[model samples]
Target: MKSNILTIMKKELARFFGDKRLVLTTLVIPGLMIYLIYSLMGSGMMSAFAPSEDQIYNVLVTSPSEEFVAAADQLKLEITEADIGDIDSIKQKLRNGEIDLYVVFPEDFDQSIASIRVGEAPDEPLELEMYYSSTEVNSSAAADIVFSYLDGLEESLSNLFNINSGSAQYDVATDEDATGMLFSMLIPMLLIMFLFSGCMAVAPESIAGEKERGTIAALLVTPLKRGDLAIGKILALSIIALLSGASSFVGTLLSLPKLMGGDMVELAGIDAGVYGVTEYLTLLVVMLTTVLVIVAIISIISAYSNSVKEATTYITPLMIVVMLVGLTSMFGNGAPTNPVLYLIPIYNSVQCMNGVFSFSGSLINTVITSVANIAYTAILVVVLKKMFDSEKIMFSK
Candidate 1:
């Protein structure tokens, strides 16, 4: 039995390595994708830091206070006066890349404030609308700057009215540890995204490519059990997946310092010692889980695909979903709750990763979650072998 398995493993590895494209599939393509995603993200953040004059922010003022007018002028913005124009026009312009912002001042502007009696000069809050252009990298940031200035205007107008904005009703209760909230979101995302993307470069092509070349049928006759064949393929993919995870792990770590740009928050909770212990242990578990899930999914996807092209097309949506989940996690969103969460496959691994990063979650949760991921992997192996055993999959178009 051992020799049979070894023979299957050796043959699978030989097939993959025999292709000069293996290095590119297993590492190069994944590395490039990682670089592209991280580069775009890092550049976005860097743009926020670097001042540029070409950032010509357009503003539409429905009604502007003297001070609001002055603020726009000082910023050298092209301020256009429009009242009750089609909101659609503004949106259309935004879509066509015409304007960066829309600022509206209510008619009661000063009257509402004076009537409120506290910060009364005008009751109306100057509403600044920013429409972001998906194509423009800085459209969102430009909107942020516009809104920030408008918010300040609101505060300043109150001060000028001699109205105290402070309400004496105090709701203050301190003394809680909230340091770990970040881990609950960001770590899970990274774990999910890296694995999913890495799989894209290998899984579809590995199985479907062989089938396309009529190579799988030849291998099926080589005295290897269908189960071992499935495992051997999964094992090869797992090694490559582990490498991708490790590379991404190192890349993200290296980029954090740059991404944060000397921020204390980046410096505060993380270090080699901390990662080497808790984070590393958790990351390893997360990675193992990710590989299993990805391999299973890929095997299923590849089995149904008669060609690599069809497989890629079928799996692209899955890639997008994985990316969206990962992106959500990057913003600190995914977290684990019940034992059922641990049983939820890919999402559970991310939740555990987040818990590990925060250091507030229990070890029991981690262990249970890890076991669940491995359990999922085992089940997938059975399903994959069933595919291998089927004559329909072997010969079907």
Candidate 2:
């Protein structure tokens, strides 16, 4: 039985490595894509993080006080004051790259303060309008900064009048220094995506490829049992998935130079002590199980498929679901922390990666996730074994 298994393994391994196109799909092409992606990312990161050259903030302040106007001028902003007329045209110009921003002061802006002091309706809330290019996230941020300054000024004035007010508002951010956090989340997502794409890329060839060349019949004629044949294909497909995952990782690493930077995204919040050997082992276990689950999915579909085309069409949705699950987990920052999260297959893996990035990583969570993943992989393997046992897979036209 051992020799039969090894023999089947050797044949599948030989077929995969021996094929030139498969080799490229598994490694080279993915590597290039990763490099290109990272390089572009790096450029953007550099531009965003790098100090601005000739940093002149062009702003249009509408009906703003001389004191407010002077403050902007002191900060090296070219302040253009204009009435509310032609605001639409001004926004168009901003879009056409005519200016950086248009800052508008509220009409009856001073009266709103007076009304609030008397505890009446704020007839005019301090409307600091910042019209910037909508396409740029940076422009939106710059607008917010300017508005915040004006807001602070209003608050200070209110305080001078002893105007009792409710507590001021503030926004809490989780991504203030999210370097490694981004990477940890992105890496697992990329892994899942590449694996999915790789499965489709190789499955047709792995299954339909055999049928096309009449190799399935030849293999059947041999003493190698049907269950063993299924096992061999699963093993072969897993290798393809692994290669694809590796390619994407390489691509990501190369792209990092472009997508991020030389410093990487150094999250100050996480401590180094979290990444112990035990944590790494847990991660490895999850990764392996993840791979196995994907393999089982492919095996079931491929066995039923007459050609790779049919199998691919069948499995694309599964692939997309995996990618989506991984992405959804990344945004679960506000999700209630629980041990059950660690028991939920891919969800567990996502949380594990998140923990891996955090300062105080949870050892218990990692172990639970690992155990759950292994259990899931075992279940899938058994399911695949049953599918292989079906005589239809062996004898069907």
The best candidate by lDDT is 1
Which residue segments of model 1 deviate by more than 4 Å? 15-21, 32-180, 264-276, 324-334
Residue range 1-397, candidate 1, lDDT tens digits: 4666677667766766788777666666655656567766776776765546567677777766565667775665778888868888787877766776676777555555455556344434444455566555445556677777766756655555544458853434211122345444555676677777667777777788888888889989887888888877887777776777666766665565555554444445433344446566677877787787787788788988899999999998987877675654445433445767667666666667766665545677777777887887788889888988888986897
Top-TM-score structure, candidate number:
2
Question: lDDT per model, in order?
Answer: 0.68, 0.67
Models, CA RMSD each: 8.3, 7.0
TM-score against truth, every candidate: 0.63, 0.66
lDDT by residue for model 2 (183-220), tens: 56566677667766776666667766676566777876
Model 1 TM-score, all chains together? 0.63
What's model 2's overall lDDT?
0.67
